[model samples]
Target: MKQPLRLHTPRLILRDFQREDSEAVLAYQSKPAYLEHYERPAPTREEARAFVDMLCRWAEEQPRAKYQLAITLDGGQVMGTCGVRKAAPGDTVAEYGCELDPACWKHGYALEASRHLLTWSFETLGVRKLFALTRPQNLSAIRLAEALGFHRVEDGRYELTCP
Candidate 1:
């Protein structure tokens, strides 16, 4: 499988994870506000390194398939991650998720990253549909999903598919 490599948007670059990203990942994940509703908060540096290593492994194994990308601004500031992963056998779809720095919120970064991944999933990976699960209290994410053309499917689930 060819690795899922870097993609560029107008103001951002979505690329594969790098070991160097550990510190930035920690900076956002460590924030109490960021983890308030997340089940897993930021990990220690060692754990973060492991997590990033996992991302690199996934990218290499699946290529244009299941992948986790590091979202960075043009200037190389690591913002967060976005990705698509294959769903269960009976599902015939893919799951998507993202996390971004709070300091970068409300600037359309999430939408840009998501759009890029969704396009890759459909056009590159041939995924038929995409789904996302977010906490009910995370209204911002819910709204962003809606704005990106995902329809609410349940309390904390949303979905989108290629036409």
Candidate 2:
């Protein structure tokens, strides 16, 4: 709901994206592993800048429908982004997901950040259900979803209902 929005876990902070985060985002986004399942080509510097600007703009909305945050270590080096977004203000359901730098993969950062995002979405945002749409071949994402207590609702769709 504000510029400095943040959610915390034991090992990380999920904070609002800042302009300075553009370069880090670009660097990770350029990796072959990161792009493996994505259809779009790697982003240019200007595209990355615009993307961060858009996240900042979304944060400024009156009844924010999205929380696209930067995932950072406690020491403040950003590793990736995570988000839970409703289709409209006051919706009881949202879509959520996270991505980390390829180098950070398998280290549990995505799991840690996603667990915190799920909690924040359910508690702070009043969301009753959170769903993730992962690519069919993204086995790591599938495993992470299952590990977090999300059940497969349908092909490519996994869901976690609030307790």
C-alpha local distance difference test of each model = 0.83, 0.89
Off by over 4 Å in 2: 1-3
Backbone clash numbers for all candidates listed: 0, 0
With a 3 Å backbone cut-off (N, CA, C), the pairs that clash in candidate 1 are: none
User: How many backbone overlaps does candidate 2 show?
Assistant: 0
> Tens digits of per-residue lDDT for model 1 on 32-148?
878876888568999888888888877776223467899999949688999888843334488888889988888999999988888877887778888899999998889888987
Best by TM-score: 2
Give me the overall lDDT of model 1.
Answer: 0.83
Give the candidate number with the greatest lDDT.
2
Model 2 lDDT per residue over 30-100, tens place: 99999997999999999989999998877878888998999999847778999998899899999988888
